[model samples]
Each structure stands twice: as structure tokens, then as C-alpha cells.
Target chain A: MHRMMSDKRTIFLMMAPGFAVFFAIVFIPVFVSLFYSFTDWDGISAYRMVGLHNYRELLLHDPVFWKALRNAFLLGGAFLLIQHPLAVATAMILQYCGRAEKALRTILFIPSIISGFVTSKMWVQILSTQFGLLNRLLDAVGLSTWRQDWLGSSSWAIASIIFVAMWQGFGYAFLLYYTGVKGIPQDLHEAARLDGATAWQLNTRIVLPLLQPVIRTSIILAFIAAFKQMDTVYLMTQGGPDNSTQFLATYLYQKAFSINLYGYANAISVLFIIVCLLVTAALNRMGRQEVGEF
Target chain B: MARANPAMNRKSPLGWPFGIVMAAFAAIQLFPLLWLVDYSLLKSSQFFGASILIWPKPAQWANYRIAFTAGHIPRYLTNSLVVAAVTIFLTVLLSMMTAYVLTRMKWRLSSFFYTLLVVGLIIPLHATLLPNFFIFKQFHLLDSYGALILPYVAFGLPFCTLIFCGFLQTVPRALEEAAVLDGLSVPGILVRIMLPITRPAIATVSVFSFLSSWNEFIMALTYVRSELYKTLPFSLLQFTGQYSSNYAAQAAVMTVIAIPSVVVYLLFTDQITSSISHGSVKG
Candidate 1:
């Protein structure tokens, strides 16, 4: 049996197809991207090696890169500060809603499952300056003064993007928290109740503390999602209104496809990957340290 | 369950507020799609009316017909379905085989290979886009379904393999040992026994792969230029250009694009949600 299981030929045959595709399609491209990042390829002309020049320009000279970086961080921060807390609070409330729990959870998760294209298109209509549902509703409610071009104006584009993104993503965040809340052993809630702890105390003092691991994971996932945001931004604004809503992925795309600066785009992608890894690593370290304390 | 938490009991003072809050949030979550559907049934002129929502006295279902014919939705939808179906099939099959080899077989570099594959979860797809474009261009695969399908399957494998590996580890070795004693070959055991056991994981992987591939926009946008190979999401971009002022028709196109994913989610909600939590937490 052991021999059969460990037969080198069979094992090799089983692994070869997946490994070949993965390497050809994903693994090799990553290395190729890294290689391209050091050159000055303009997609049309013969490329010349210019070691460190692309990164140097991207790091020190590019204001748009800085803005995209800042905007990505802002999106990440909003996910952590705004979206996560609301999701948690909603999850906490839903946990106590006896029969309606599953239905509500399903409804909340619907947004996350739909295509980003659909979400962006829907929001674009809702936020349109002339025929927007939002502004129209605001007028009906006598708040017409508050109307603004949600996706067109520079001041509101990023915030609108963030809002649409948060709306689209709220379901997944809510689901994570809901599952975490459900996974909390019933005894914890019972024990707290027996000790005469108020519901608020039971959640804050007991439930929240026990939810540390899920919270850490959720935060990490949120940051990854935020940094990786491109589809919605691309569909809605394409980082328009003079690049007001630029994200890392969209900016890299614009540089590569639109402007034909393949080398600089590759440099941006490499840094993008590094930024994601660093953020994930930092959060993981913090999580481990906190776990050590307990 | 209701008796387990008195606060959640219907008779409790907090019940009404909790129900209201949950209902309100559910409404907020669902209203946008409902409104989209509503507007899709209205005439284009009615879209700018004073009311935020108008019940179409007579529904403009023609918008859907126009979207289907004029918007080139059938071609895009066919492309999307073919790409997604092929991607899901290949990803599930390859990942299952790879998972079995990595977990059940004793090999010197199994752990190394497993780590390498699992690390793909963090590598953003943007990093691969440019290189992949050139690679596809070299192979003359641009404007072909293979261009989208290959990368989709490649990116889908890591997560699917991870899920399958997690599932495979939990299956006891006794069943496989029994199969071996019954004179079953390794491939037979894998096919007849392991595949049956991993159905839940397969469902999870299929849904994940389908969602990723079916709604994939950037790769399709980059690799496929001709309308012949464009996927469903591309229809919206084209509709935005072609029917730029036809708001109702555009809404119809958007609705059509969103329906398949919504249907899949409805069918596999439990598997999808559970797999997401399991996959991400473990990942």
C-alpha cells in the first residue's frame, strides 16, 4: 500500500498538470513582471536595461503614485474603521433575532456575491448628477442643497468610490462576523447571563474579547480587498476627474495599457505586491503577539 | 435554540428593536438591486422623473429584448459561460488530484510544493496582468477564450487546492487502506473513494472558481479585443458606449449580467459562505 501510494511515476503524473499550468500562467508571470520592472520597455520599442531607474522615478518623483498609495491606504482604513465596526454591530444584533437570522444574513450577503460590474453600474445610475436616485430622493426629502455629482466631482469621487465599495463589500464582512458570533459557544453567553452581566457587558466584555482571532483575520482580509480594489473603480470612474480616484491596480493598468509605459507599470505592480505582503505580515505579527499575551 | 438565549426570545424586550434593525439593514442591502430592476422596467424618459421610484404602469420589458439583441449579450454570455464552465472543471479536477498527491502520498518535496502553491493566495492578479498579456500575445492567444480560461484556472487552482487539501486531511486513512486491501489501485481509490468524499469541497471550489471567472473583467478586457470572445461583463461596457443615453436599456444589461451569479449564490449560499470563512481563516 505504501509503495502504491508513493510510486514516483504516479505521483509525478498526478502533480504535473497542475504544476505546469500554475507555473506557466502564474508563477512565471510574477518573475517576468519583476524582471520587467527593472527595464525601460515601452511595449513598442526594443527594451533597454535600466537598473533601478523605474523604481527610483516611481518612488521619489511620481506624485500620482503617492496619491494612489494614499488612496489605497484610505480605503483600507475605511474598511477597518467604518465597514468592520458596522458589520460587527449588525452581526451582533442579528444573532439575537431568532427566526429572521438566516434570511437577513442571506440578504446582507447578496451584495458581495453579485458582480462588481453590476454594482458599479447600479451605483453610477444612482449617483448620476442629472438622473440620480440619490439626488432625486434628496430633493423629495427637501435636502436638495446636499446634492453633488457623486462620481464626477473630484471632492466626492473617492468618497463615492469608497462608499460604493463599502456597500458592495459589507456583506462579506457581515458574514464573517456573523459566523464568528455564531461560533462562540453558547456557554459563554449563558455563563455571562448567570453572572447577571447585562447584554451589553456580555458582548463587550466576553464576546468581543473572544472574537479577537476573527477580527484579526477580518482586518487582514479587508486590507487585501482594499488594496486589490480595481474592478469597481475601473468600471465607474477609471480613475478619472483628473486622476482623483486612482487605485494602485487601476493606475498600473492605465500606465501599462493607456500610456504604454510597461516597465513603470511593472514596477508599480511589484511594489503593490510588496505593500500587500508587508501589510499582511505586520497584521499577522501583531495578531501573534496578542495571542502570546493570552 | 430560542430557549438557549432569553434575550433572543420573542417575548424579550429587545426583540422588536433587533428585528427592526435586521429588517432595516436587509432592506438597505437589497434595495439597490430592487431599484435597478424597477428602473430597468421603466421607459428611459421615466428615469428622470420626480419620484425616486415609479411603478411602471406597463413594464418596458422591451429593454431586455433590446439588451439581448442589440447589446450583444448572447455572445458575451456564451463566452462567459464557456470560460467559467471550463475553468471550474479544470480547477476542480486538477486541484483534487494535486491535493491527493500532496496530502496522501509520502514525498520529499510535498511540503515545499504545497507552500509554494498556497502562497498564491496573497499574490494579487494585477502583478500578473502585464506579463500575461505579453505571454498571451507571444502565443497568439489574445482574443481567444483560452487566454481568459488559462489564467482563470491557474489562479483558481491555488485556493481550490488549499480547500481540497484541508478536506482530504480530515478523511481517515482507514477507508483508503480498506480499498487497498480490496485490491484497488491508487487511481481507483482516488476516483471511486476520494472523489465521493470530497463532494462538499468540490462544490465550494466550483462556486469560488465560477464566481471568479464568470465575473472576471480585467483579464477579459485586456486579452480579448474582438466582440467574439468578450464575456458577459464586457457587455455592460459596450452598452455604456452604444446605448449611452438609454438608461433603462443599460439597466437591463446590468440586470442580465448579475442574474447568473445571483442564481448561483442562491443555490449554494451555505456552501459558499462556509467555504469563504473556512478558506480565508485557514489561508
Candidate 2:
């Protein structure tokens, strides 16, 4: 009892600021967004209660919401399938590389460290229709017909953007997998070789299984990144060409700030949170099986 | 798994070709950056020089001169510098306080506080978009450094606190207990005993907070409207104009904006790289 009194006071003092800032800024915003989702506020006008009306419209009436959600899913799916594998492959190759390893790692990591704005601008120049490098290169290679306005065309815009994102992000995911792969003992690989396993066989039966945790972590992170991505998207397309590349983050901004429909944006945010939660939970369930040991 | 004979030791089949392929990939990866340097160094006349090798004939070191010719960049760089400095100071302070208290205190609610910090991880920026707009407006802090700086500290505190808390967990408690027994006071123990032991964590937190605040764009875009109050990203975004559509100058602005993050990233790659690669995800 004597010890408890002083301990309680000190602990309270310690935990106060963290909880205070977080509860006020983060948690409060979450709940307020929920509350605002039911209103008819245009962000600057007097509010009116339209309980469940925004949600109703969003669930049944809105196509863009679904489209944005699907875009996020496409982004997430690409990260998991393409980016994650390439990150793993890059990291694995670098890890197996004997000399000049640090140089290679540093070189690979430069793109990740630069501002996304710079990379997006670079890609816009590269993928643009008239004077793009890709088109120029294609013309030089006698494959000029293969050239297209990657960012201008609606069909290819989202995919091209995803490709740029993956290209820039491959280093990060590669670093993650590289770190995890480096953690696995060299003895295990040698033992597998002693057991007469070929290179491909060892990778399939050993390295991949051991890397399940890393892979899951990579997928979850990549998915979350895909969902909240704004910087590159902001600069690259600005959710443009008739909202073809619009996402939840950008859409929320469009509704609340650009279009002045704060209440509806709040609804989108509420739903956005729910969808992210569901996706994360679903992934956790899928990744729940044991990451096997050597 | 067969440790192939080291490439240097054997002239294996396709060794040179494989080496060439990997080198080509590296070249492809670095080509755009090289192009960035190339463009930044070119005159408007020679800027679009046809040959990649022969381009940038006379390197215009003056592009850097033209970039800072009285605009938001200087102000933006200063604002970002102040914001980053203030953010690191306040966040590291708050993290130390929160981490120490949570670790040392004997309250039922300390665990809850720790959990709240964790949830801060999953709180997406979009979730807070509308509410914070209302918030800063009510506070009358729109387009001010206060508005930008305060939210940044709030966002960053959780991340640094997480690391500090984790670091605190690994620290032996006897030193803290000794300080307490010596009646040095709660604050004194943190300053005197805890801080010394947690130097690496603080260094990690400082580097991270500075880089993140310096690089962050979404909040700055949402909250900061006035060009006067804009940070580096904001400045770079609005650098391009309707008249000239100055791509070369914009590249210069991009270089200016890229400097602090790139320099800091390279300087503290060991810390930032390890921390980020540790997979403790935050915005």
C-alpha cells in the first residue's frame, strides 16, 4: 500500500501526455469522424442531422466509393504479388552476392530515400506521350508502335502508377526481406545442400518457408502503404483523368476539402477505416499459420 | 544451396553475362537520378541535347543560383528546418517523459497508455482528415507554423515513444531504483540516469523525427495554404509556373528540396535504415 501510492502518482504523470495527445488528436478524430458521418455539413455551413443518410448513399448509391476501394485493392494485390516478390528477389540476390554487397545495397536504396515528388516527376517525364523517354527508346528499337501515353490513357494510368510505386518501393521491401533472410543461418542452407538439394529446391523448400513471417509482414505493410498512398499519387496524377486513379485517401481529401462535402467525406473515412481494419484482420488470419523452422 | 565457387575464383559459364545483367539493372535504376543531375547542369539550349553521353555540354552550375532567386524555397527550407528542429526537441522530450513514466510508474492505466500509442500506429491519416480541419479552424491556427508544428509533434510523439518504450524495456531497472532510493526525484532519474542509458534510442528518435517531419507532405498540403507558410514539398509542388513551365528550374527546386532528406538519410542511414527495416510501421 505504501509503495503503491507513490508509484500510482508517478505512473499517472508519465502516461498523461502520451494518452492526452493521442486521445485528443487521433482517437477523438476517429470518433468525431463517425459522428460527422451522419450529418449534412458542407464543411463551412450549419450542420443538419441526416442520420445514416451519408452511409446509405455511400453503400448503395456511390460508384466512386466502390471504385476507389477497388483501386486500393488492386494496389494492395499488386504489392503482394509483384512488389513483394521482386523485393524478395532483389534482397535474396544481394544477400547471396559475395563482394560489392554494400555498394549494391546502397545503390538500390537511393530511390527509396529520395522524395516521392522527384520520382513521380521523373516518371511523368518518362511515361509521357509526346516526348517521353520510353517512347523515344521504343522508336529507336523499331518498336515504335508499342509506345503509348501511359499516364494519359485511362486504361494504363492506374497500372503505370502502380508500377512506378513498386519500382520505388522495391528497395524498402527488399531491405525488409534482406534483413530477414540474413537472419536465417548459413548452416541451414549448407545442410540442405549436403542433403543433395539443388539451388531451386533449397530456395523452395527452405528459404521461402523460413521467410513466411517476413513475407506476411511485407504484405501487410505493402497493403497499408498502397491504401494510404498520397504523395506520389498527388504529384503523378492527382487522382485525375476522370477519377480513374482516385483512392480513399485522395477521395477523402477531394470530398472534404476540394468539393466541400465534409459530412460525406467523414462517412468515407469511417468506411475507409472499417475496410482497412477488415483487410488487416483478414491478412492476419491468413498469415496465422506457423512460419516453419529449419 | 550449393555455395557455388566464388565468381572471382572461377570463370564459370555465363558469369560475365550475369555480372553484366546485374550491372545493367543497377544502371537502369540509377539512370533517372543521373538524368536529374544532367538536367540540373544544362543550359536551356543544351538542356535537351540529343545524346545521353554528349548532353549537358556546358554544366550550368548557375541553375542552383536561379533556383533560389527569391521564392518560397528559402522560406520553405527555413520553415521545414524550424519545424523539424522543434519537432525533434519536443518529441524526444515527450517520448522520454512518457517512456520513463510508463516504465517506472505503478499505475493500472500505464498499460492502457502504451496500448493507445500502439493504436496510434493504425490510425490512418484519412481518418483524421476532416476532423482536424475542423480542429485547426476552431483553434484559428490555419496556415500558421503552430498549426503545422503541433500536429506534427502529435503524430511523431507516438512513433518515438514506441521506440523509447521498447528501449526502456531492455534497460536494467537497478540504476533507476538507485536514483529513486537516493531521492533524486522522478524527473531527475530520467534526466540523470535514464537518459544516459537510452542515448541510442534518443539518437534514433531524433534522426527519425527530423527526417519524417522534413519529408511529410499530406499534412502540410492539407493544413498549410499560404505560400509563406509552405514547407519544402509545398514549395516544390507550386514551383512550376504557367508561363515558362520551367522543367530545369523545377529540377533545381527538386534538388533543393531533396538535399536535407538525402543528406540526413545518408548521414544516419545506419540508424534510420535499421529502425525502418525493423518493421515498426508508422506514417
Leading candidate by lDDT: 1
CAPRI quality band, candidate 1? medium
Alpha-carbon shift of residue B45 in model 1 (angstroms) = 0.4
Cα shift from native, residue A228, model 2 (Å): 1.2
Candidate 2 Cα deviation (angstroms), residue B85:
0.9
Give all candidates' CA lDDT scores: 0.87, 0.75
DockQ score, prediction 1: 0.67
- Give fnat (model 2): 0.37
Residue B76, candidate 1: alpha-carbon lDDT = 86
Report lDDT (Cα) of residue B124, candidate 1.
89
After the best TM-score superposition of candidate 2, give how far the Cα of residue B117 lies from its true spot, in angstroms.
2.2
The residue-level lDDT of candidate 1 at A227 comes to 88
- Per-residue lDDT of candidate 1, residues B1-283 (tens digit): 1134444553467766798888987998899899999989999999878987789879999999988887789888898989999999999999999999999999899999998886677888887899999999999999998999999999888888988988998899999999999999888998899889999999999999999897778888899999889999777676555578888988999889888888999999978887778755774
Residue A248 miss distance in model 1 (angstroms) = 1.1
Give the per-residue lDDT of model 2 (tens digit) for A1-294: 227335766766666775677677777888989998989999667999999999999889988888888888898899988878877776666544445555676677778877787778878877878766677778778898999988877778898878888888877887777667666777787688779886567677888888888788778878888887777777788787788888888888888888899899999999888887777778778777875565
- Candidate 2 lDDT at B102 equals 69
